[model samples]
Target: MNAPALKSKCLPTYLVIDTSSSMKSHESLLNDTVDHVFDVVGNSPRVAEFAHVSIITFNTDAHVVLELSDIETVENLPTITCQGTTNYGKMFQLVKQRIDADISGLTHDGRRAVLRPAVFILTDGEPMDKDWATQFNALTDASWRRRPHIISYGFGTANATVLGKIATKAAYLATDVDKEKEAIVSMLTSLLNTLVASASAQEFRIPDDVPGYTRVPIEFVD
Candidate 1:
């Protein structure tokens, strides 16, 4: 007898996360930002269907934190604690690896080739480790660069100059860095909502290359 066919389903996927500390005074909201994303994706049809998600977190160290999975179980999204300093180089590398690993599984699962994963990187502080530039270039190598859309959003007065460079061409400053948690949540909703829509798609269209305005709109300059 033949074995049952594995359920074949398309997956709209992306990475959403917070960057290093911003405005040391308000650094405690990083986990809230991640939780807000989970709540948004968990509740939305745009992201809940076949759209899977992964999370990466960085502060003094970088980590994959979460793996790609359906939003149904997304409530288990880990708490992102704030400690140490920023390590942009390590964080970018972690992101690259996560995507690369998932690509293999997607190919074998009879799933369609993916749209460039949308990466929403929200940060309020700078990388404590300066090797970030070299790491950024390596991760931005043509392969990874072409495969994912990285958007850098700064909150609580994060340095726009820095966020701009990380996001490449697409970057924005949050409306309120002091109250960055709510701002990050709104940004996460737009990103996940779009990703959910993308997953439900038959063919991957480069999603709107623009950042949808959020609860508190920030001046986006790239």
Candidate 2:
């Protein structure tokens, strides 16, 4: 019998989380949610066969907590540290550069090119950076062809205006940040499902309603 051939096409998924001081109170919650997400994806044969996952955390500065790797290879998801002010520009720039480098690496390694990447961002506060929009726009430039589909999520205290600009396809806001425990759980569960589905998908689709979130439609600047 022949060994199974590896899947040719791959999907890259980025999870960008906020680690500003405001999020300190929810450290445990964030940790557990991320743990569950990684566990679910790592164990799913479908996701493991088609997806590469990465984790990024940002506050005053942005850094990659986990570099892009096959989901199956993810052992420990880093715990985010809460400090400094939120700077959206710093995060966008980091992602843009990393994605460019990552895609190049994948192609060089003789792997089929990745489809448009998917980015899931979670933040609970407003951005403090001036001119953050410029960086965000550059990152989502449609001309790039490989531009990612960004799905932004805001906790209760998050600024809807900023998130609307950050998200490419959808922006979801929680009713009450940490107080609504059930809602938060539901939202995280829905996010996990979305991430897993995107691994084998070529297009993006948003759920009508994510148990604990309300869709906030955004108008992209031309």
Candidate 3:
């Protein structure tokens, strides 16, 4: 008897990067890190088979540099450049809208299952927008499904309080590494590996802890 082919499930992953003026000095390093991370994920059978990756860049505004595409089909990933002030509010709003649209597309396009997406926010500075908190709160409201587990990575002048609030699962401070750029790259690589392994095993949630990454404490808001 011929066995039926199992339906392929899709796990959407978003990389939200800060391209504000503060990151200008390390822009090249950031590009290299992104390239390497994508290479590792794109080459992995587990990730390539199930992961749909997207890229979003935020500064004065937030925009999707790359829409959701399967790892195997994605090529020529874009490079980020430092620009205007960081507007976390704009970023959060765009992310919320994108998630809604992406999920709908996945459901309609024949994916057997579309797991809760994972969002990785990497930044080196604080938000210049006053309404960032409000936006973040709305984006992560309890009513949302699985809420796209957010993992924040902050360094350089980034505020811990902001990162913690934005992270739904855990926020990490990428310090302690010998070199700042190297540490950032290493942290990103680790994230990619963890994401691929978990999604391959059909686990979509981000872990609360990762080796060598310092956890940031979340702050309570009234």
Q: Using lDDT as the measure, which candidate wins?
A: 3
Tens-place lDDT digits, model 1, residues 1-222 = 985465445453545454444434444555665566677767875556556677777777787777877677765666565556666877887777777787677656656445456566867666677778777776667755344666776666467668767874366666533455566656666565556556566434333433432222223322
All-Cα superposition RMSD per candidate: 4.7, 3.1, 3.1
Give the per-residue lDDT digits (tens) of candidate 2, residues 75-96.
7777777888899998999999
Give the Cα error of residue 99 in candidate 1, in Å.
Answer: 1.1
Better of 2 and 3 by lDDT: 3
The lDDT per prediction is 0.61, 0.78, 0.80
Q: Which candidate is the best by TM-score?
A: 3
| Residue 91's lDDT in candidate 1 | 84
* Candidate 2 accuracy as TM-score: 0.89
Question: Which has the higher TM-score value, candidate number 1 or candidate number 3?
Answer: 3
Local lDDT at 115 for model 2: 74
Candidate 2 displacement at residue 81 in angstroms: 1.2
**Candidate 3 global Cα RMSD:** 3.1
